[model samples]
Target chain A: MTDPNKPASVARRTISTPLILTAILIALALIALASGSRPFNQTVIDIFLRVILVVGLYIFIGNSGVMSFGHIGFTCLGGYAAAWLTMPPMMKQTLLPGLPNWLMQLQLPYWAGALIAALWAALWAAVFGKILLRLSGIAASIATFAMLAMINTIYSNWESVTAATSSVVGIPIVRTIWPYLIAAILSVFIAWAHAISRAGLALRAARDEPTAAAASGVDITKERLIAFVISGAVMGMGGALFAHSIGVVTPDTFYLTLTFTSLSMLVVGGIGSLSGAVLGVVILSSLIQALRWLEAGVTVGSTTFGIPNGLQEITLGIVMIVILAFRPSGIMANSELIWPRARPEKPDEMSGTTPTQQGVTK
Target chain B: MQTLFDALSLGSLYALGALGIALIFGVMRLVNFAHGDVISFSVFALLWPSTDAVALVFAGDLPWFLLIPFVLLMGAGLSVLCELIIFRRFRGANPATMMIASFALGFVIRYFLLMLFSSRPKSISLLPALSQPVEILGARIPLLQVITIVATIAILFALTAFLKRTRFGLEMRAAAENFTMARMLGVRANRVIMGAFALSGALAAAIGLILASQTGTADIQMGGAVMLMAFIATVIGGLGSLPGAVLAGFLLGAASVVMQTLLPIDARPFRDAFVYGAVILVLIFRPQGLIAAPGTKERV
Candidate 1:
């Protein structure tokens, strides 16, 4: 009962790692802030978006122990909201002919649009999540993916509301470093806060053991609802930043490719940890850009490096397969690396079934 | 009338797609997101040889019968390969992981197909005679629609017979009920699962061929929208219940077509919303799925 030395040793190991990592990250951020070339600026913002996507994704995937195919739907809502609100009235009239008189009359500031967009996405999530949140594992995932497909179809075809054509325009361009930096910081903070909260504990319980959690009176549905809403809000805000960052939105933009790319970042960095989300975003986004360079018909010295024009996707697929095979748990697995505390095993651990899994699957 | 015909034909395709979806879900409990791509993959197979080699069957010179089996085999092979590589290992994973893997697999498959096919839309001409319109009670319907309906019924009939009478079919049904138990009882569950995937793939391929002929073009994105519809059909039909899927498939098809016919021109675009909305309502009322397995703490 009196293992004072061991306790102090464990504390030292846990407390020091985060301080080192944060210091390193801040240094890297400073370098990014003062980077050169157009690609460098784009890279910073790309990391920011990935940060939002990855951390938000982890909340659902890590907490409830399910993958969501429908997170893309919220991203679409976020993009469209920003696109609709920030579109200048005069410019929107020119681009989107015969826009509703009511729509044309309303105007919003850039930040307000971002906030509203986040709220709108969160609101949608609340309605959708109420039904969707309760389903775990594959059922939840399929439903989410279904939502994405259905919403994308609606967005692509609902010409009056979203544009008839796939292409959209009239976003104010703000291609700079601030948005990405702020997004990354906020996203990290959210992840940190989420991991430590009471709801987070119940979600972890649900992830590991639904029956036990249910027995303890943890309302699994409510936990999922909270995660879904908060995650949607974060993704929505990121979309707002992206709309202004990229200065355009398309139906295709928030579809599978975006979903896959975002998911890939989380996969590469690791799935279970906050640092993994941040680190994975940075590493994977840079790698994608690097891969593009390798394939971009370029020559350095007497050597030329270029893959088949369409090989980029194939390469990424290969990497994903390898990762799944070699490290089914992404880099961080489901455990965080910093400010460390005792983490519990997911209730629905893959190797064996609990009473609920047996009950449901049977 | 033309719009109504188009909607009916499209809904018929959705039902066919849904049948394949239900079979896979019923048996494996995997969402099989790749189901739609199997159809897409078959379309390319049917269209490519005809497009690339003018001498190939269905290039307006060769006999149509020779090409039919080729298309069918392509469907069968693609389904088998997908089953072997992806869905096999994923058994017993959280349904969420399985679903994501499927979604990922579907993405990779479509993009890879796109890279191979250069993302162009393709079509197959089954029969020029089948292209001409037939007048039906004030509705001018293409002969292809009639052929599609007939083909769907014929295939379903054949599948039903196969499932009931064949040794392999019995094994498949048994395995679907309980994989571990069936295996312990000496069923070669792997072989049975593969067979289910193969048969389902064939249905999708055949549907893809017939419907692509009607719609006049095909593309990669086509798989996903239809996959969701098939998912609805499967859900409505009941998980692991074959008859349930078929019943819901045909009913949903007819309902969607009727709804589209009644809708205003502008609202016609939103007909899918009505179908999916209806599915959600159905699901709320029947959470176990329309035709659920009757057991507690056990699957069929």
Candidate 2:
């Protein structure tokens, strides 16, 4: 019934999607390794963090058809947890005296702290998702945003514990790129695995056709909550790594700007596809780095010229708008990157055009 | 008594902001995140382009009559321009896409302002006469507070009359209720949306003027807090319901003032956390909001 040149089957994609993404990531890591420039290495690490965060975002938002403005709140929790666990006991004694005696005395390896941070964020996600997953559409989005604002307010004002708005220093920074690279790869695998799981299928079913899926005995709320908790864990891990990537953590760092950045990246990458999430970060991060270089001054012959100080952000905003205007579903339009040689004439079946592009506003 | 006045004045500001946001959401499902940026832009319109600590008051020096309309017109003009340039292309796009686009637009506006007038907060005396205290009944209130409350009520009354008595208002209300149906019934979609933008922008301008007068400073970030609170109000009131939004805005203001007055000193700093917690609880309990407008319910 199918042509020889048709898109690969679901089985082929199951193995191939992650493989292709992993190869791309490895290629990026290899390039960073070859370059050996400190700033460029740092930039790659930043991109890796975004990869983890955006992929984490895709786990819930991609499958559920719900936009959450609060996942970065998990990143905040994970970052603070990393700070509390990894900061030197002597520094904790002076800066965060309000922490419990055991917590104050505890100093953790970055890996252990990251693991605990994941669980910590997961626990809170479960709690919030239980209450929030019942709402649908825009109201749900607002509730999640409220959750983020609450976390921000509490963290910003909890001076004795969080040092208020002041940055908490002494988070052991990991300058090596391996840990972040591994974490980014791990997040992508987790996302791919979840996408193939039964719950993920059910959640996606609910997203595309809520009435039919509900009629077929899908517990929409439970499936959504499951995705919520898993994504929360991924976000938590990303947050801890984010703290380690920088030697300091502040509540402000995880607030609106980061929220919009990750969301924009995910949305721009193609909110519905896993490959889109990974590639979105890579492409946008590279563009941003290039813009920064240009901002610093690009040398052409003997002349050096640079953009205005704030034009990077302005231009980025314009670029995002143009991208969205031209392709509302994003650059990938919700389809993964398959083998170019075996391109499907009818498009890939599993993650074809998302339900969003089909004109289902709700 | 002073507490009540404070609550009312604050409530009036939120009400105006909610009204502005509600107007646009009613026409299109878009939640116009740039409304706050427009507020900031309107205030900055009064100042010359400079990054200095001292604000070079330009249009701000005009008589109060001209100054007020000038700021309002700036807000309206900017808002309409955004609708034409950016949002017009996004007609019938998914809500998430539109929301992100609006946010991106706001980012561009905020950064543009940052380029023109650095991140530093600039202080300017706006309508200095409004600073005087007037004794009303037993409590002395700032004249501006009384004016704010009265002006809000007048605006509400006029808006109600327009919506009820005029052809344009009727068309707008119909579009808000159901855009497709209204269009089929001969209402022009772009016209209604543009009108909504203009009115929303003017309300943002009004809030800008009031905020500038109250704070005596124009900071790039000044509109952010008010915008967030007003956004919450718009949702709490119900997305498409005008009266509901105004009512919810006033209620939110009262709750905020009451909490600030009643919370213990140590817990005062966490007031926003408590407020946000209450918001979460409200959404959980009334996902349809306190007042659900007709036709907004999803079809099963």
Complex DockQ per candidate: 0.29, 0.82
Among the numbered candidates, top lDDT falls to 2
lDDT of each: 0.69, 0.90
Look at candidate 2 and give me any clashing residue pairs: none
Candidate 1 chain B has its poorest 10 consecutive residues by lDDT at B51-60
Q: Candidate 2, residues A287-351: lDDT per residue as tens digits?
A: 89999999999999999999987889889889999999998988887688766654564454545
Tens-digit lDDT string for candidate 1 (B88-194): 76766544345556666666777677766666565435556778989988887888887777777787788889888998888877777777778999988778888
Q: Tens-digit lDDT track for model 2 on B1-300? A: 999999999999898999999999999999888999999999999999999998999999999999999999999999999999999999988888888889989999999999999999999999999999999898999999999999899999999998889999999999999999999999999999999999999999999999999989999888888888888888888898899889988988888898999999999988888888888888888887889887788899
Worst 10 residues of 1 chain A by lDDT: A351-360
User: Chain A TM-scores, one per candidate?
Assistant: 0.84, 0.93
For model 2, the stretches where C-alpha displacement exceeds 4 angstroms are A1-12, A341-362
